[model samples]
Target: MCRLFAITSELPCSPMTAITALDVMKEGHDGSGVGLFMTDLAGPWEEFKGAPILSGIFTNKGLKQLDHYMMELGFTTKYKLSIKLPKAPPPGVPKRDVYLIRAYDYPESWEGLSQEEVNHRLMMIRLQLRQMGLDTGDMVVFSFWPDVIMIKEIGDPMTVAEYLGLDRKELRARVIMAQGRQNTNYAINLYACHPFFIQGIATMTNGENTAFVPIREFLESRGFPGYIGYQSDSEVFTHILHYMYYKLGFGIEMYKHLITPLQDRDLECHPNGSFLRHIKHTCRRLTIDGPNCVIGVLPDKTMFMVQDRKKLRPGVVGGKPGMWAFSSEICGLDAAIPDRDKSKDFQPMYLDTAVVGSDRKEVKIWRQTEPLPLQL
Candidate 1:
């Protein structure tokens, strides 16, 4: 199992807060790798929310190639976060030539493109860059989106953070998801790290997906380029979310239903029973099996958590207004936000989903058996 820690606040906070929480639950993970996905950026990045930021590791040659490629495509660098490493990296941390997080102006040819078109173009660019790097083993692109940045490395969570100097004020964000990976299922590949991102959606999972192959086949057959990478079985969780919410135009609440659908007896009493039955039948291949707990962020900044149908994994959400955290362990939550009312800390069962809207004020538990509000 892996340790998942995510926190969202009205004010920008450091990723260290999530890293510290993961440390408290160190025994749950093997410390083989660490991954972070951050949005609603603060500091210098706060002002450039409209520009797409590229976050990845690069070799010296790869960086030069990226510069030339972007320039050829008419993209101009807007702002970049400069990273300065110590003379010697911490023990166990592999040395890399450059760690980049740069924002760029869109190519002049894309001036009149719609937002959807721009998003498609950005994803293609990221995929092309990924393939380019794969061919040469010189780059590892995590995300290419506005107001988002991702980082992953093979090492202890805290040690990796220190090595990257993540404590700098410029790296703060209002929402951050961090995962300490156990590496039980796959070899330690940086691309397989959790807190995976595509377009504006991101998710991290704690347990294995027993139904990975079917789910992967269904998603890949959808003909979506963004759904191609399956370095980790858990990556399908994020794509399933994008398909339902972004492609099918379904509400986020429906995600819980599709992944962990209710039994026929239970669904018979649901307010939207017939509609949900159709969904279950039509999307049966998307159902997930095994012990899993997922924490994800939507395009609108809504953060949510859901458990498998059997509730096989542990998860808890707690904190005061203006700040909240979703952790796999209550001990991790206590480490992240101790001043909140413990009595209000919630652990959703097999039929529950804990959702926190963009406001970050309250957590709404959407029960599968209960009727959803008209607006969602």
Candidate 2:
């Protein structure tokens, strides 16, 4: 167990939005996870080494050096690590199958490729899928067009033809054209810092779908128009880390270590690259997310939150004190439900001002909305 330490300053106000000068849809489709996993990103790992019970892929032989990290400002005294140790986690077979199609080695700017070449490229992608193990359930996250994904045999060629009740041959052609190779070839790569703790990703999903969603919202905000862009999986993840993960992400590494005990140990069922963070970090580090810092997490400087689908207020989070944190363990939205049937109606605490900064200055903000604009 660890003793509580004071936050250096009053917990900073929660950051509501984030959009940087560099817009990268450039990170891997997979982004960071929700909440802090380990105990600490600073100070000593010794404080959390033997805090009761835990297990990990690695025994901490103390051979490698640790990097700085960040997480939300919550405390976990006696916690169980669902997965830990060893940078990567056991992997699992895809729900169906996947494939790495031909590499896209376009010039920094595809100024050279003719439109005809682009068509050939999309057609090649479709043919590649047919040859690869990819099927209806198989997945494909393109390094260039990451957002567009090919989920095996999406849409019904037969369904389309039947729905139109037209010539089977002609209907198939139109249906195929509508669904198109490009659409099936890529997906809109959305990332959220605090992914939801959901059992499975369904047809409708919020930030839990990916780690870069929070900042994505900010990028699409009125403050910035057309600020974010994406083409490949790597650029998408890199842009996410560049905008959001610079400092606080390493803190997530600490969270990663703490949860080492709870992970599944079977080597076959689960393999390396399956662990969420390892997948995200590897995506970022390998440029599977983006080419350079151009595609990366926003540093600690940027603040944002991911609103839980059930809890309208929850969103992507990062920073030190009152740092960005999300939890599936405790359900705030569940608790927020009022006991109207009781003797009295209950309301959550709302402070007009959470704190007074230095010089006794008054800082006002809203809980349901963002602060007013600042004057130049």
Q: TM-score per candidate, in order? A: 0.98, 0.21
lDDT of each: 0.92, 0.21
Clashing pairs in 1: none
lDDT score at residue 287, model 2, on the 0-100 scale: 19
What tens digits encode model 1's per-residue C-alpha lDDT throughout 1-376?
8999999999899999999999999999988999999999999998899999999999999999999989998999999987878878787677888999999988889989999999999999999999999999989999999999999999999999988889999999999999999987546789899999999999999888989999999998988889998888899999999998888888778888889888999889989888888889989999999689999999999999999977778899999899999999999989988899999999988888899999988999988888755442
Candidate number of the best TM-score? 1
lDDT of model 1 at position 277: 88
Q: Give lDDT: candidate 1, residue 305.
A: 94
Residues 1-376 of candidate 2 have per-residue lDDT tens digits of 0000011112221111010000011121221111111111112222332221111111122101000100111212332222112332223211111122111223334457675454344334333432231333132322112111111122222222222232311111000001101121244221111111110100111212233444344334524221244322222333333323332343222211211111233312432324533544433322111101110011122211112222322111111222222111112112211221222212212111122122222222223222212221
